[model samples]
Target: MEQLICLEALSVILGVPIKPGSKGMSNVNELNVENLLFSTFFGNLFNGGPGKELFVDMNGFLDPQFDYDFRYCNDKSICKRGDEPYKRPCGWYRFALKVLNKYPDGNTWLGTDGWRSHSVAGEWPVSYHGTTIENAKKIVKSYYKPGDREKYGRGIYSTYDIDQAFDYSREFTSKNGKKYRVIMQNRINPKMRKVCKRQDYWLIEIPEGTSAAKEKEIVEKSFRPYGILMKQV
Candidate 1:
């Protein structure tokens, strides 16, 4: 059997060294549905300790109430209820595609029972509270090319400039012969209003040909473990 690669192991493999205090992981308290989804996906890919698993709360992911909240901000929280803020569909779709591309198997196995239970519906089919698999799949496919941006407009906040995003998109080729594009936006979280130092939103485009297995290998070999001869101080 192949060795399971955990997050710490992946860190050593990637050579993208992370210090103990590094902000590699986001805060769960501030996590919205999409953030949680991404976290769960990545966490499952690398964290392989006993009783550790990755699971999504279908209720939270698909609930129309929460969906509306996720898209808009009410009160100080960006994801508060009753606030119909504009959501960039293109960005959301892009995120889903990246995850699907990375985890082609769609194994959906990771994390503890508590996590798993919240992730699926009655029959073990991965179901979000109010979202259909069709919608999810549709979202993933929508962001395959630059043209899709017409529907959602330019992203508000992105780490890479437009040119870089376009260039990155060209590098990856999906199984279907389609290229990838990234749409980023800047979002203001009211809760963090006091700090007001962090930028709103920055979306990164995941180039094509990047697979979950390849990422796992990268994390395992380049990120997780390194040869270090320790010296006593």
Candidate 2:
């Protein structure tokens, strides 16, 4: 059966290896820097004035004096709830729409705060697809340190927990009378907040004969709760 892996969970199983020349930066650390600098500035700039300005990205926009934290716009209305509160003409939605329309070219100016404001440290999930269970296990083992290898004896370590969030299997008979089964797995990493768990997911497999359009539709439906996303490697 084919296996699906969460990208972030794969990192944890592999001890969250820091990239070469990364200077020991973790995802949480990067998220912090993003929130402190970019989010604080753009958030206020858009929500501060009337909701009709195109946010140009040049100049000394990073100066702290220009970094205003408009607390009024930071509520769940702008970040979470999806009703009248979110659609209010004077709300962050209007501000976001204006920015998006003006810069139909791209969202480099529209930082990630609007979509990911609810996702805090530890709650973020990563994922991968199209691999085997044995291969996945081997990949995780490859990241073990010398001490860890010595202690755990090669590919059998328990330092990290692999939460097999979903496992689905179904059998089908093709027009040629050949029988096949599709197996899919969704794996999630440990959450940042113990009480407020996040449903991080990655699909493991699609039945061999499924069309590309069907596969896309399946993944898109699964990914909606997490917001608009691009295909993950």
TM-score of each: 0.22, 0.17
Cα lDDT of model 1 by residue, 129-220, tens digit:
11122322322322212122322232122211222333322122233343322222222222211211232223222234557565334322
Winner by lDDT: 2
lDDT of 2 at 182: 18
**Candidate 1 stretches greater than 4 Å from native:** 1-37, 48-171, 184-187, 191-233
Which residue pairs clash within candidate 2? 6-127, 7-126, 7-127, 8-126, 122-192
Best by TM-score: 1
Q: For residues 41-83, what per-residue lDDT tens digits would candidate 2 score against the true structure?
A: 3333333234332222222222222222222343433331211
The number of clashing residue pairs in each candidate reads: 31, 5
| TM-score of candidate 1 versus the correct structure, residues matched by position | 0.22
* Candidate 2 minimal-lDDT segment of 10 residues: 88-97
- Ten contiguous residues minimizing lDDT sum, candidate 1: 224-233
